[model samples]
Target: MSTAVHDHPHGHDDHAHHPSGLARYLTTTNHKDIGTMYLWFSFAMFLTGGVMALVIRAELFQPGLQVVNPDFFNQMTTLHGLIMVFGAIMPAFVGFANWQIPMMIGAPDMAFPRLNNWSFWLLPPAALLLVTSLFVPGGAAAAGWTLYPPLTVQMGMGMDLAIFAVHILGMSSILGSINIITTLLNMRAPGMTLMKMPLFCWTWLITAYLLLAAMPVLAGAVTMILTDRHFGTHFFNPAGGGDPVLFQHIFWFFGHPEVYIIAIPAFGVISQVIPAFSRKPLFGYTSMVYATASIAILSFIVWAHHMYTTGMPVQAQLFFMYATSLIAVPTGVKVFNWVATMWKGSLSFETPMLFAIGFLFLFTIGGFTGLVLAIVPIDIQLHDTYYVVAHFHYVMVAGALFAAFAGVYFWIPKWTGRMYDETLGKWHFWLSFIFFNMAFFVQHFLGLAGMPRRIPDYALQFADFNMVSSIGAFGFGLAQLLFLYVVVKCIRSGEQAPAKAWEGADTLEWTHLPSPAPYHSFETPPMVK
Candidate 1:
């Protein structure tokens, strides 16, 4: 993708309305449009996935499967994980990359424009297949997102649908990675060296590499499972000399890094937003870069941490335990940098800043819990419990999802040239923060009290906390409506934003672009210095 912004009537002149048509979306490969598509699509998937979460929470509300059948609840859980991971969070970050990277780096478009279009178009059908699975005779795969065998083998058409969807989603992600890598490497404007790229770009570059390496592994793992389910292979079937544990080895080999692939850019977003709101250059820029790369490298070796309870040998257990624990060091460095950047700076808590702070506090709580879970003995007690679920929700939702919202609020002026209602944004932030923690925090106690995960019903002893969690879930769900309203209101009408929306912002993006960036950007590279 070229990085130059060109003069155009629609993107440049805010008054000019562009045509809305299939062709406009289909034929054009503009990074902004594609980025918009990804954001909107991911938002749609979020609602879809969120509904599934509601179903899960509702079913577990009173522990008697009130709203849905046990089978459907299982399906909801499985689909919810799949959609949130692939359809929501992954695409949202890619959307951010598409919208921001070129602008930040002074590029015109992605490196491979047509391929970008192809990558996005692939998602809808794949998403449709996933949604469509619930209606199939055997219902959506109840095997959970992990798709471990025996149970997975029993799932009928839904499993096949899921496998096929995985193929398409994987292809889309890989192609998207290729486009990103190409753009960052080959399309950066003159004087924009690799080290000079923004933290978001750096994190994404590493994420894309992780995606490239791990997505193929996922593809292969799923394909093998598909063959095992249909073609009489025993890749994970003990009856035929294949081992289920082997399946885990391969899956986690991909799955663990896949966690960071979704998260590292979130770290980048938090890094970007903190400095802007804090009015300080990011502290430890080089340390942040090295920390992210270190995380990516360590992610490969720590896959077995998820499987410590599967009776791995003692040495294997110790290795994964220690390897996984080491990640906390780099992650801690990142947290310290963010806090240090804010120390004694001219910090005003804007909505974006509020969310960034929320991410730090809540994500740190999750990280501490993760360290506990990383210990082999504790993992034995907590594996596959609501405790584990709570941990990741903090990391993914409070961490990744919160950071995603911050990125949106921080850049909305650039995207829409309108300031969102600040009062409403703050309302959305506080309400979301309170309700989100309300929903997931107590789940830790529930997990500690011997409640297993993925079950629709629980014993009477677990009722009180579960009720609290359910109420919190509904509240959190309602709060997102406010988010939708805030975003839509900004898009429709708000105070006009200036060329540089935030005072402390320093990316090439703010320097080169107007409020609401041009459809074609940077016809000529601006001098960086």
Candidate 2:
């Protein structure tokens, strides 16, 4: 059940690379090229979302609104969450899956290569719809990222545009899921059995299925909103015999799993990166697999935790509360497995490892906060406060975003055929780690102190912490420019990388493939022993 792929290199002509330029990108089916596109697109959107975040932070810098009004501030909040979640983080992982999966599994390319191309292409128009909606008449959906109703139902053309964008994104996710699932199931090398595959693949396998199952529910939720808004229906409209609370049920059903959709992949990256730097096989690999599956199974039952404030019956609230707490068990199993992997191994503090460690520390805080929020009495006090905001950023920004930076540092050498400046990489890590904490950590105090989220202005006492957060937010945003420079320098010309850049890296990409993986990763099935 434990195995690794052993791919054989082919003749030089087999490296017949794809054509260069805009034309090639427009029509190419090469997964590496496509993966590059996804990463770049995600980065672009990351900046877009980050800017929106700064606008939010700046407005809140003082008790009184300084820059924007409440309505526009809500727009920034709405678009920021949507862009970061769908446009930045999700695609970034898909980029990794596109680049890593076939290579790791010892297959030539994705099973449905053309479908892969279409799936990636679908993102731009979707992102455009979201971003450009700002210039529209009603000025985007001010109804927060959740798109809760009555508010959403009354919003303008921008809302419809957002709905269409969600539909397209859902379609894109479905198509990408199908490609990933089909490739993993049918195209894996002869000996790469399910249990033998890398933890990253397993996480993605679960994540793809999560997407397949969860995305349609979101599609249905949004579709109902669209119909209710434009058509004669009142699914969430009280006047039309609709129940708005029902929308929360549907949305959270999709939304809760969406949290894992992002985190699971981040967990996958941490799994790979931690073991590599620690020079150890992942501890509890088998348990990690089972724990992942368990978490996925538990995700469905816990959706209603978000609805605790809606005045559902105590029995229903208790069901969701306990169910929510149960997910932490498997999640903790993952955390324990990671820590055990690094317990006494030959650890190195490379940029990737630094980011991985940061992820572990901050993500745990995020989880603890999540558990705190899971309690009915506590959540009733803290729900929708800056405390909730602090919790998720710790999860999404520290947890998922840090993991992403770790992955990029870990693999940039292989992807680009060059090693990045180690000093710059380290600088990037330290700066990001420091500035990130500055920005969001105080928000916890703000939340505990009762500052609400999505508001442009706040009460007098919250001013100092808001200023600190704004400064930290700006610093955090600036640190990413260094990350961008580091990656660009690597691609343009850093140091030439060897076949195995990291001596401890043991996967097929490191052990078998050259520094830059060949255009056709597996011309024939690799004999991985």
Candidate 1, run of 10 with poorest lDDT? 8-17
Q: Please write out the lDDT profile of model 1 over residues 64-136, one tens digit for every residue.
A: 7688888888999999999999999999999999999989887778999999999999999999999999899
What lDDT is obtained when candidate 1 is compared to the true structure?
0.92
Q: What are the runs in model 1 whose C-alpha is more than 4 Å off?
A: 1-19
Q: Whole-model lDDT for model 2 versus the true structure?
A: 0.92
lDDT of 1 at 384: 95
Model 2 steric clash pairs: 6-528
What's the lDDT for residue 516 in model 2?
Answer: 78
Residue-by-residue lDDT tens digits, candidate 2, 1-529: 3222334444222455577779788888988988999999999999999999999888887788679988899999999999999999999999999999988888878989999999999999999999999999989989999999989999989999999999999999999999999999988887778988999999999999999999999999999999998788899998878999999999999999999999998999999999999999999999999999999989989998898999999999999899999989999999999999999999999999999999999999999999999999999999999999999999999999999999999998889889999999999999999999999999999999999998887888988998899999999999999999999999998898998988678888888788777777666666677
Each candidate: how many clashes? 13, 1
Q: Candidate 2: lDDT of 306? A: 93
